[model samples]
Target: MVYYAYFQGKAPDVTKKRFKTVWDIPKEELLAPGHRMCQGCGAAIVFRHLLKAVGKDVVIVQATGCVEVTTTVFPETAWRVPYIHVAFENAASVASGIAAAIKALKRKGVLPPDKKVKVVATAGDGGTFDIGMQALSGMLERGDDVMYVVYDNEAYMNTGIQRSSATPWGAWTTTTPVGKRWRGEWRWKKDIVGIALAHRVPYIATANPAYPLDLIEKFRRAFETEGPSLVHVLSPCPPGWRIPPDKTIEVAKLATLTGMWVNLEIVEGQPRVTVKVPKRKPVKVYLKMQGRFRHLRDEDIAFIQKVVDAEVERINKWVGEEAIGPVVEE
Candidate 1:
């Protein structure tokens, strides 16, 4: 079933522009420097911008993954805000508890009645799409007032680049290696956004680091909305994807330009494409840059392009406009 139309209603007023210029953004740096993340780690950028958008009155519950290990090494921490490191499969569960605690404290006069603190749960694709699915489902079903952000790098990059359900079709990883009898990952990427939509969350978005303004605006919306919210970010890994550190932003922008990734948000049961692609670049332009798809044959690339085209067409039809256009050969 097409999940984009699942939430059919009047669209909210999203015409107002926020962050017109870089100077309009707050200068406060919530995420300090001097961490151990790689030079071009896209997840690090996601965290930095997220904190800036949400500000200092937030509690971050992060799963044990690349960001957790790299940022919070025993004696030092890069986060300037309240942060808790939880097990891989329970970040959502912990965040739910924290939200519940804040409510209880406020009711009993233990905390100020007007005190507002945002509870955010963060995890990688391995933790979100695979191990933490059950916990996240429970949090959504229970109607917890927490925002869950998944910085998907496509695989378990912290554990040697193993394949996860979020990994794209025909992408090579340690487990899904290209060989004589087998190609890369045979299955399509899991639809975490659709799954979250099924739970009837108040807010859901897909973000990329290449578009900082859009990403920050989505975070602002998620924080303002009540009930459970989910933001799935496409975080490119330099080491795992076998790309140079400097090409992280370039590859991320290519994903959206090629219709491989769509920036969108669902607010109050209304879905809209945030960034429109009038003329999509061929999917090959995106696939050729990453070493993970280096071994894919011509036919394999054609097959992948066919899948992307169908998906983009479906989205365009649902939105009643050509938000993403047909692929054009370059």
Candidate 2:
């Protein structure tokens, strides 16, 4: 008697040896140069790495946000593949419609049935976790054959650095400013991944630009998955996060090392922590490095530490183990 699972032979191993540096990324560039992204834009890095992993046989639907605004400026467009720009709160919904059209076309022999084109929707925290939640939820609940990737910078970076639902606790934003009434963003970061998990999508994961290999691998898995896939990437914004341009990768690394952000994936309803942090660093090390957390008092920092510790504890409980976070060298 032979027993098996859907995980067996589901897809080929496309993760070519673990990637380490920027040079390890593919030479082919999908997003053309000469765009108006920031000096040390993490979103651009995420876009490039994801395109490298997903390849060119895809269609992209970009919601109105930083990436869309910066890349598509009227007469100038940076996208090299088939791309569409949608309203601020409807990228996923538009992508769903496109996917449905493709399926209908293929069935009617109007489009090549042998060729497969993946639908990918890109948005920021403001568009995804806030304004676009309804449409995004609809897409996920409907089980559309599309990938919704949210490049979470934790705030509305393009709109004067306002606070979005993805903003973490104790961080300062324009809206969640330090004042007599507000001590930075008092509310905790919204768990966008958890919301996606509730929909029980076929694939769900978290990625960070700091770990290029891991980020790229998650994209590959998302594209290969048949049903809806949600990938939440913690893209650090230089200005919004109040960090130096060059410290983008370093800051992002500290986030994972301090257990503030844990790399995870959900497959067949089984949760797994892909990156292992073994010995977690103190949250202060991660918070003190960012300017956004500069206003945090001793008590505030302690509060953040408690939040991080609780998050790490929760992840450990789910994985049924300890020290199970991304292995990034401190």
Candidate 3:
């Protein structure tokens, strides 16, 4: 009987969570208790940890997506920190503006300049990989002092499981469900990290809620950076991904084990990848665990593997590291 899985009562064991000590982290609350989110919602997890990293002197700009709606209902607000909800595609630019304004205010000594403020934008994969992409690219190219985090559950979860450019190839979404005659989602996930790297931001990293401490550390680092930074987070949408609520972190860990999400980073002072992905588990295990890929046949599975292989190979070449993910053998 662990005291980890309930709002106030008993429930099944959730994905294994590590306990924190008082000396390790503060008891500050940012997301607050009244916000509405699903059980095992990865976005909420990321949001909480992200706030913990940046602390209270931060302005959070969010898009009109799940996070924004859940936190800011018309008559109520759940955010303990200053927050602004922008249009679906404007979160990045709005964060950039907020950062610029904060910097100007601090320089003019309008507000207490000693209290360093961080500007963070939280957006889903759809807003990031689709609509907000251009604005994000522009922000990074201009080297704005903002941190943008994408809580990627791999689809448009806020809009009822529609496929997004971040959705994995074999995963099933409402629009890309595998029928009897069809294979699965036709296109591959857009390589947003590669695109971000091409822009050459000061820092770019991939994080997972399964690894909360790691995610928090990256956020702290990104928050302290002066130029534009991105932390691509892999969140688990249990209902959207057809996994059980208890398996949110499990699913996230499986993503890393399957090479579906690589935990790597480009540091501010370096041009090479400072982190490396470990030997990964089979993709089939990760795929079959989700009902979305229930209809994938063996050959179709092989095709997905090929796509992942090519993508990993390209990343390895870019990083000058030897290939570490799965490859098709003769």
Candidate 4:
């Protein structure tokens, strides 16, 4: 039997070079020229593509994470669009407020009657998976018309290179500092999508920077919807992950290929989303590519691979050809 969740009523069209350049987006640069991100920050790349998809007619409520500090300076900022720097744990609530305010502002003619805008809360995995999970869950339950994009680099990147709930098992971080006694972080990556599924939101999807156009479409569709939307984007962080700058996208691709992360999307109330099966490589191949996991031994790799296989099997169960063609949950 095939399992189908969100992405309902239609299939996600992945075709054409919709974004030729960064300027192709009419929203303008909401997250600007920059103050202090690393040479190959996957979050930055994801941000650029996201802005291109959603456009600048939006208000960004950023958490006190890497994206927030790196782009926004107190007096002067890089944001060309209206943006807010909320606390570490309240970006979702803040963005929800902004959405409500926009509605009221338009109703009272405070801004404009025909104000076409969206509230997007962008944060790292540290914010989304760990500290900010409560706020994120609250916003989803509230079902605010907003987009919560988690640029998950698997660590608390901004403050320092620390492990996060989203960090996969067997990865290294400051908190999970690897040594002879320690074999890296020993916990599994929390099932963020499963958590979102628990909320039963209208739309939730896992994305990758390797497939820019697919990610863009998810954002665009999420924008058009009426409730909360979650896009779990696996963006690569070079400095923290100890990978080269240009290798961000490639590393991101390998993540899925190793069955560590699979690409899928869930629409309103669906049982599962469209899943793209990977080539299924050894997790060690991915681990070895990054310096963070350099200390990992063959036994460690085997153990990690077992976890990854389980994850892939779970996702595969959610993806199959059902009697109902591409069914939507709602």
Candidate 5:
């Protein structure tokens, strides 16, 4: 299907060879190193691979969050490509404006008619799930030719370990503290994929930095797909989650193995699991590694398991296959 609707005449070739492994990815680095991002930051890993997948012919619209602040101090920056730093609530809006300007420039013959520059908007959970919802919604509803990415670390890790709408149930944060009356955040994580699906955009997907190849492939799909696309990534935070720096990727993988996070892609409204798990580990196996859920009682863990079970079942039914099987006690 022709997805690039905003381009006049004809769109540039978006087709590219699929990545078979890490070695297949481009060697060029668009995001420079030596930034202020913490060690083992999942978002940092995400940006590295993401830039490699999309190549250098892209513009990044970054929201005011961890990635933006850390990567772009007053005098230095980690970005090598065209990058714009916007507010916490308007990354999508600014990206949409850029896309529109590109379309206009192509039509006016001011820029090369066949120039193919992809516009990508990136934000953390706080900017995406909470503050940027309105601007994001407008972008998707307008069917702007852009790809919006959310590197969700669950809470507002940049400002502080504050609870966001994306924070999971029974997880501790600065806002959702554990005490006599309150025990972490009591609400379940918001279904961001579902919300994007409602907009009927061309593409929607969930990715994890732990699965580098899968994450790269999904980014390719999002970049090639016509209209607006959203890729929600599960990013692990070491300081916020209270885990060691080296445990970032391990914890991210465990999230999928225990059904806490499902790796899937929805294209043109059809959903399918991109990375399948034949068998699942118990939820506690995933939770115990992080200090955020350490205060969770046995009953609390059981409740979380039930929630994961239901979500897994729902996704499997939608895909017409058991992508993630029932949890097995080991």
Candidate 6:
């Protein structure tokens, strides 16, 4: 899949040429450079990189959230392709409807028979894990030929940093503030990728913005999949995460290295570790870098570490082998 392409060395001629650059990624800007997104916004970078991979023959359906608010600021839009704005929880439904309509139009000869247009629905963690699950599930069950991408920043950052189901354990947010009553959000993060795999989507993968080639490759795969497909990206927010704006990519890289976030691909309900870590870094190396976890006591950090270790073990067991090496180039 394109999402896992960064891990692989072989590539098609086009991709090979693009990889000759310093970052081994394309330079074209489809999302434009002057958008209202915050400095070092991981989601914004994801959008830009995604468009560069797919080119101009795509339609985007965006749900109400940070990406929509910042990019489509009333009178202007940064998108160079066809873009549609939908309600917070209806992005999947809208994308499904658009995909179906395109088929109908082609059948009626209203459009060229050979024409191929891709439809992509995007949302944040709040929309995907909570408010939009019903609509998303419905679209997946119906086998809509649309790609769904969730730029998971782990909270409702647009709505004042409220804790969402995707928020990591022990992370601080407005509702999950650090105080005597609570050290941070105490619940486990929701597993949306696992839920999508259960729906039996043809393709599903997790990506990271730090690895641009892998991120764009996943976008290409999701668009090419025959049925509903999904790609979840670990988008880091500078202000919300209490990290330096320029450290977005660094933080994301640490997340995968520390085993806090695993990048995997699911095909026909089978999961493969795309970015394997032979010797995972300690979870504290990732945790202590962000202020959201600053309130965690030593025991709290230890508990988080144990959870990550168990997850890594589970993935290895599922694959029937230990990881051979790191997926991304160090």
Alpha-carbon lDDT, every model: 0.89, 0.85, 0.78, 0.76, 0.89, 0.84
Of 2 and 6, which scores higher on TM-score?
A: 2
Q: How does each model score on TM-score?
A: 0.95, 0.92, 0.87, 0.86, 0.95, 0.91
Residue-by-residue lDDT tens digits, candidate 2, 169-218: 99999999999989888888888988987777767889999888889888
Q: Candidate 1: where are CA atoms >4 Å away?
A: 1-15
Q: Mind giving the per-residue lDDT tens digits that candidate 1 earns over 53-77? A: 8898899999999999999998999
Q: Which ten residues in a row have the lowest lDDT in candidate 3?
A: 3-12
Which stretches in model 6 have alpha-carbon errors above 4 Å?
1-24, 324-330
What's the C-alpha lDDT at position 39 in model 1?
Answer: 91
Query: What is the Å distance of residue 222 in model 3 from its true position?
Result: 0.7
Candidate 3 residues 1-330, lDDT tens each?
232121111221223323343245556878797788888899988998888888898899998777887889978888889999879998989998997898888889897878678789889999999999998988887778888999998888888999999988877889887777555688888988778767767677888887776677778777766678889999899889888988999888877766777777666423333234456576787888888888888988888777777767776887677646553332
Task: List clashing residue pairs in candidate 2.
Answer: 275-325, 275-326, 276-325, 276-326, 277-325
Better of 1 and 6 by lDDT: 1
Clash pairs of candidate 3?
A: none
TM-score head-to-head 4 vs 6, winner: 6
**Clashes within 3 Å, all models in order:** 0, 5, 0, 12, 1, 4
lDDT of 4 by residue, 287-312 (tens): 88999988888888888877767666
TM-score result, candidate 3: 0.87
* lDDT digits (tens) for residues 1-330 of candidate 5: 354343212222334449887789899888898999999999998999889878888899999999999999978989989999979999999999999999999999988999989799999988989999999999988889889999999999998899999999999999999999999999999889988878877678899988999898888878876678899999999999999999999999999999899998876666788889988999999899999999999999999999889999999999999899977888
Better of 1 and 3 by lDDT: 1
